[model samples]
Target: MGERTRLKRILRGLERRYGKIEPPPKRKGLPLIVATILSQNTTDLTAIRAYEALLERFPPARRSRPRRNLPRDSDGRIDKIKIRMVHVADARGEPNWRAIEKAPLSVVRNCLRVCGLAETKTRALRSLLKALRKETGGYSLERFLAGCDTDQALDKLSALPGIGVKTAAVTLAEGFGADLCPVDTHVHRVSGRLGVVSPSGGRNGTFRELRKILPPGTAHAFHHLFLSHGRAVCTARRPKCDSCPIRPDCERRGLEEV
Candidate 1:
């Protein structure tokens, strides 16, 4: 069978085994960005805990005054308000990003210590927030989210500090429900093993190839289902090929020794 046909069959099997995949509720802008960054190299549960700790430690600040008569910055080049007035309450009262930007690195790192690469993540957070403020005059991604060009939006997002193609694709996928498949470890492994895509170029290459063949409007489901399959049945150490729903269709590449 053609790779595309096999992929469709595998999708059906995965859906039968795991149930219909639902797109997560839309989470735009900063909160989604922060969550994505926190999730790096860590389990989703651990990332949640770290994000919660961060929110608790640096709770949302009181709403800023109206922007009708906004003030200028120190440089006085623009009329950008020193405080972020918009989108502050969008996260059901998101953590005070301004506080995070100014907080000592050690303090922020402590909040994220539960996750991997705490120090690196801390620096990234600070740099990311600051860069957003400078670039957009606030901690907001509405501009990218609202853009008509997907590639342009991806480029802008990927240019941010500590964000790569995977992160950018994930942000667009989860945050705005964009038609982009993020190639993480799970997606990379599962797709490769299933023979849907060659893994010769690693995650980035797999991502590019997968996008070319992914069925229309199925990126969200494809990502979630493959990720679930990888985690539960096609695991790295000991995949349960015997019980795998897609076993019949999977190539089982690199599993002979396993």
Candidate 2:
């Protein structure tokens, strides 16, 4: 079978094994960006706790709501939505990035201590928000979502401090639902073992290869399901290959001894 066809079959098998996977609820750009940064070098549970801590540390500034909800159309006519007007920071529960930017680095780092790599991640987050403000005149990546194509978006995000292709790809996939696959440790391992992509160039290389052939509309589910499969079965050490759902498709690269 062609590579793409084989990948589709594998994806289907994964779906069957895990039951249909879905992306997390969409997060606003800045919060998602911060959360992705926290997710590095940690489990999702830990990352979530650290995210919550960060929010609690730098809670949103209270803003009075409009006296009445704005009608969708006072005249009962729908109007075209303007992408520029979408400021994700204005969303309820979003932390005050400006507050974060002005706070001491140690304070922010303490909030992320639970997730590990607190100093590094804290530095990255502060730098990223500051850079966003300078570059976009605000603290949101919504412009990338509204304006850039997948590749362009990836380039822009990857250039940010404390962000690599993995984090950038994730922000795009999870936050904006862009059609790009990110190669985290699980994804890199599973894809290589499944013979979907050669593992020569590490995560970024695997990500590039996967982008070329991952079936369209499958990026989000592919990422989550692959992550689940890797963690549960195709783990870094002593993977449960014998009963793995996609065993038929696996090349078992680097697993001969196991």
Candidate 3:
């Protein structure tokens, strides 16, 4: 079969196996961004715990305590005071960016240590948060990503102290659902096994080649789907080839042998 035909088969089989792609849980922007950073070289469960712990320690609104039942105005309407009260109260007990910003590096590092990549990721997280505060005037993650294209976003994120291509792509894919593929170790390995790209090339080549082959708007979903499939079925050590939905196409391509 032609290379293009094989790839089309692979994509269709993947869709059959995984069903339609769903957006990951919608989380507040900063925490989601932090969690994506922390997920580097770690398991999802571990990353989630670390993210929750960090948020517990440093909620997004730390400047003032939340108030309840403010007095009404002469019109008997709960005015701006009530609005602020509601906003604060709703935000009460959530992660505060101010607290995170003010936290000692050691504390921040320790908090992230639980997620894995303690040494490297801590520095990245701290640097990113610091830059966010300095550059954006606050922890406005939406503002930070605003007006940036996928490539621009990737460049901006990878320019941070410890963030790299994989981390940036993952963050953008997960945090903003941007249309970019994140070729991590798993995606790289699995893509090679499926003969989508040559095994001789490294992750960068695989990313570039796959980016060329896949349809433009679906790259983000395809990235997540590939990662999830890698974790769930196409594992590194021993892929469940027999049970895989794409086994026929893979076998035809000698992917299992590879």
Candidate 4:
């Protein structure tokens, strides 16, 4: 069978075990961005708690920075450096852009502390939202993307502070239903070991190669299968390869314990 056919067969095998793949009822656009940020290095439960806390702090009519150029001394050395004046405000209606843009840094940090790297995440959240405001004249992520071409959309999303290629690709796949998949640790490691995708070029390269080899509209399901299988059968360590449904297709199967 062709590689794409093998991929489809793999998906079918996993689906029989894991059932359907469905994303949760997430708040699209801005909220989706926040959730992705919160899930950076934390567990789902921890991230959810932190996200909920943020919502409590910045409610409706509210919700949710300017950079100053540094002046150098005559020596062209750092004599006096200006601190970035973090802007803050209180929202009146709902947790909206106006509220997030005006909220103080401390509040945003505290709200997301449980997710770890609160300070960094808070800054990213603010930076993206502010960028959105500048681009759209308001906070409409869908509209912003709808107007931009695929490459343009990916570039803008990738340029965001906390958004890496994986996150940006995930956003496109999950949020916009694009025919692409994001490779997380599970997907990357599993793909590498499966010998389906090359081990070089890291996760980004794997994403590219997988996109080329896999059939259209199957990237998301392929990603989901790798994730579920990676966790349950073909794990990074102590994998249950003997019990795997697709072991015959796994070139490096059980190499985890070797």
Candidate 5:
């Protein structure tokens, strides 16, 4: 069969096996953004822990004036106040750059330390915030998103001191629900294993290859699906091939049988 046909078959199989792909929980601004930054070169659970620890140290609302039900967005989306506490408790919040930028570097670094690689991520985040402020006149998430197109936004973000293709893509895909794939280690590895791309190159190559095959508007969903499946089944070490729904269609490019 042709590559296109094979890819289609594999995607269909994945859909059948995984069912509907669920969008990751929409996080509040600061915590989720911080979590994404901490997620670099770290496990998700560790990132979550670091995120929680940071929030605990810098709770959104003090004990005296506990956060109450803030007004939701016009679309009925819950306001930041209501969800900020949940993010503090569990480290699952929206992407709030304003809150994160206002946080002290020491506090940010300490929070990130819980996940390991604290020093590196802390520097990166500091640089990112500084760059944002310099470029945008202020680090306003809504304003930034409104100012740039997809490519422009990605370029601007990647130009930041610590941000790279993956980080920039994450900001677009997760922060704005853009139709782009943030090819992290898991997505890169799993895509190669499933024969979506060659195994010889790195994540960027895999992203380029997949972009040619995937539909324009489907990249966001595709990224989430591949990521979720990679975590659940197509793990880096000893992927559960038997349990994988797409196994029958996976070419198993560079991977061994489970």
Candidate 6:
């Protein structure tokens, strides 16, 4: 069978093993922008925690206060008031995008310190918001990019601060349902070991090449499957190649033994 056919089989095995991989609900464009930024050089769980913390602190409040009907969590207490004021020292008003855009760099730095590289990420968020404001007259990306094609959106988003092919791909795929695939560290390594892409191709090149080879309408699921497979079976240090579901298809290119 051909490599593309083997890829399809691998994808099928991943689906059966892990079920369908869907972007979580409520993850629109703006939040995804921040989440993707926070996700760099960190565990997904840590990135998720940082993202929720960011949203919980900001809450997209139309005014200084969070929504009146905002529900309390398992901890109990509808503390939107407190959450809203958590960044009062740094934010001019509430912890919303407007506040972030106008807030002094130090305040924005404090707000994002939970995630690593607070200084860099804070500037990126502010810069991204500034760009959105220019594009849509305010904080709206999904609506602005609604009519844009995958390549167009990719090009635009990749131009943003701290954004590149991988980050843009995550945002475009989850937010706009774009068909482009993202290539991260695990995907790069696994792809090289499988002969799916050249070992020297690099993440950006792998992304370009993978897009041409992967089956249509499969990029989103394929990205997550590669991630899961990288974490579980084909780990970097000592891959469980013998038990890997796609071992038959993998070329084991650089593998010392299996």
After superposition, the stretches of candidate 1 with alpha carbons farther than 4 Å from their true spots are: 62-93, 144-148, 253-257
Q: Model 3: per-residue lDDT, tens digit, 13-55?
A: 7777766666644334565556667777776556656766776
List model 6 lDDT by residue over 145-165, tens digit each.
Answer: 767898988888888888778
Cα-based TM-score, every candidate: 0.82, 0.82, 0.78, 0.81, 0.76, 0.81
Residue-level lDDT tens digits of model 4 in 1-258: 587777777778888876766642233556655676777776545665676677677766522311222334588742221110000011111255567778898988898899898988888889888888888888878877877765677788988898877767766766677678778777888888878899897989998888888887788777777876776677777888888888777888767665
Candidate 6 collision pairs: none
Residue-level lDDT of model 5, residues 1-258, one tens digit each, is: 487677666667767765665454553332334456777776665766776675566555433332324335577864321222223323233334556677778777877787887878888777766665766687555465576787888787677665677877776666576678789887898888887789687988887777777766677767766876777788788888877877866888336653
**Which ten-residue region of model 6 has the weakest summed lDDT?**
81-90
- The 10 consecutive residues of candidate 5 with the worst lDDT sum are 80-89
Q: What local lDDT does model 3 show for residue 175?
A: 61
**Per model, how many backbone clashes are there?**
0, 0, 7, 16, 9, 0
**Candidate 1, residues 77-190: lDDT per residue as tens digits?**
322212111112233346888889988888999999998899888987888888778877778877534644778878877777778888788777776778888888989998
Q: After superposition, how far is residue 74 of candidate 1 from its true place, in Å?
A: 54
Q: Between candidates 1 and 4, name the one with more favorable lDDT.
A: 1
Supply the global lDDT for candidate 5. 0.66
Go through the candidates in order and give each one's C-alpha lDDT. 0.75, 0.75, 0.68, 0.69, 0.66, 0.70
Candidate 4: stretches off by over 4 Å: 22-27, 61-95
Worst 10 residues of 3 by lDDT: 81-90
Candidate 2 global TM-score: 0.82
Cα lDDT of model 2 overall? 0.75
Q: State, as a TM-score between 0 and 1, how close model 1 is to the true structure.
A: 0.82
